[model samples]
Target: MFTGIIEATGVLKELTLKGGDLALRVQSHNLDMSDVQLGDSIATNGVCLTVVAKHSDGFSADVSNETLGLTRFSQYQKGQKVNLEKALQATSRLGGHLVSGHVDGIAEIVSSNSNGRATEYWLQAPENLMKYIPYKGSVAIDGISLTVNAVEKNRFKLTIVPHTAQETTIADFKVGTKVNLEVDQISRYLERLIQGQSSAASESTLTTGLLAKAGFIK
Candidate 1:
């Protein structure tokens, strides 16, 4: 698991293709790797990758085809900057929301604008994943944990402060830039729990009508 707190911006030094999988070597930048072991997991742009090899300044991980298909990593090129976050330790503070580093889908930046000292970005998410996104909820965009400022249909808005923009790769985002998105884990678990209960409930169906009847909606 990760905290979605980006520790540094790393560079994709190389990508060697082996069959359908890829071996990626990334420059660690300012990320401390002294405690990182060979089997440790690192969240690279919100995708959890296991450390396969260690180097003086970086590490390498193997990327499966399934991960590539679900994330924007397939579009990444050598020298591209990526957000990096080490796995959360038990003693570490929960600075951001819990992130599994499992990319649910890819989202595209539709628009961007300045909001006082912060930059607000409007992104369109995959239609299948829209139900998991909610206004005022948490979403990890390219590994940066941010709050949803607003939600409209399959799109949502996020506001990032200057510090966040400077410390992570989010500052480089532009219109149409693709990003890895991980929705709140709690939402997925709740959906599963509801589905399980609904399967057992005969008249107590679970649907939009049920939500409205329960006063969860107006």
Candidate 2:
């Protein structure tokens, strides 16, 4: 689990294609590497990546084909900047909403505009994932916890402040940029509960056709 709070911005130093999967080496000058160990998980651009190897500057992890196809990591090139966050600790403060670092789907930045000291961006999400996003809901965009300012059709709005831009990779966003999106974990759980109950109700409904088919009544 994670807090969706970006600790630092890291640069992709190398992307080596080992066999069929790719191995990534990220270099970060700001992120603390003292406590990080092998097998530890790091949220990289909202995707949970396990640390296979660690160095003084950064760490290296392997990316599977499924993750590559589902995320923008496939489009990433060497030297690209990425947001970084360590896994949440039991004693860590819950500053942001719970983020699984599991990318639900990718979203494309449709538009952006300056809003005084902040920049407001509108992004179009995958059609099936839009129902999980609600106005004023919490979302993790590329591992940065942000609130949904508005929702229109299949698009949602986010207001990025100067601090956020300077601290993470939000400053690099542009129209047509693809980003990993993780909706509120609670929302997904609630949806599952509702669906489960609906399914049970439908199965228990006794229609005349169902009764006749089952030979229970005629």
Candidate 3:
């Protein structure tokens, strides 16, 4: 699990083909790598990647075919900047909402405009995932936790402050930029619970007319 809080920014250094999958190296001068070990997970642009090899200035991880299909990783270019966040520690602060680092889908930036010291952006999410994005709800874009300022159709708005833009790769956002998106974990669980209960209730003998007779409805 991750907190969706970006710890530093990293650059894609190299891409190597390993077997049928791809291995990529990320270099960051600001991120702490002193205690990192093999098999540790790191949230890279909101996608959880396991550490296969550690380096002095960066690390290498293999990207599976499933991840490439669900995220914008396939379109990434060499030297592109990426958001970086280490997995949550036991004593870590809950700075952002719980993020599984399992991106649901990709979202595209529809528009980008300046809002005083902040940058206001409109992004179009996957139609199926739109239901999970509510006004003022939490969402992780490229692994950076942000609040939804507004919502319309399949699009949502995010107001990125200067600090956020400077600390992460959001500053590189532009119209049509594809980003990894992860919705709040709680919403997904609630949806499953509701669906499961509804499915079980299908065998009930009570109906709307029965509810009216019982004074539960008018």
Candidate 4:
């Protein structure tokens, strides 16, 4: 789990594909990786990845084929900047809402504008993923937790302050760029429960119909 509070911007040093999996070598810029150990989970661009190898600059993690296809990591290249955050510790502060570091889907940045220090970003998400993009709701974009400034159908806008821009890689977003998105955990859990109940209700209705058709009900 994570808070979506980005601690630093990291650089992608190398990305190697071996045995149909991705091995990422990154260079942490001012990110403290000393506390990270092998097998530790970390969020890179809002995707929870396990540390396979460690170094002074950064650690390497293996990305499965499913993860690659589901996330924007497939589009990343060497030298690209990425947001980094350590796993949520028990003693850590909840500066942002509950983020699972699990990317639900990718969103496309329709427009990005910066004035002096603040930034305004408008992105279009998938209909299935827009349930959590309510106004003032918590959404983690590329590993940085931000509030929705406004929402329109499957699109939403965000206002990034100077501290967020300077501390994270969101400042590098451009129009047409893709980003990893993690919805609020509360919303996800609630959605899951609602879907479960709906499915159960549908199954019960189907059973009743079957019974009536078989002359069990008059």
lDDT of each: 0.90, 0.91, 0.90, 0.84
Best candidate according to TM-score: 1
Write down the lDDT that model 3 would get.
0.90
Whole-model lDDT, model 1: 0.90
TM-score of 1: 0.91
Per-residue lDDT for 14-128 in model 1, tens only?
A: 9989887898999975989999999999999999999999888889999999998899888889998999999999999999999999999989999999989999999999887
Clashing pairs in 4: none
Q: Best lDDT goes to which candidate?
A: 2
Candidate 3, 110-160: lDDT as tens digits? 998998999999999988888789899999999999999999999999999
Question: Can you give the TM-score per candidate against the true fold?
Answer: 0.91, 0.89, 0.89, 0.87
Model 2: what TM-score?
Answer: 0.89
Query: In terms of TM-score, how similar is model 4 to the real structure?
Result: 0.87
Question: Model 1 residue 80 lDDT?
Answer: 88
In candidate 3, where is summed lDDT lowest over 10 consecutive residues? 201-210
- Candidate 2: lDDT of 202? 50
**Regions of model 1 farther than 4 Å from truth:** 197-218
In model 4, how large is the Cα lDDT of residue 59? 85
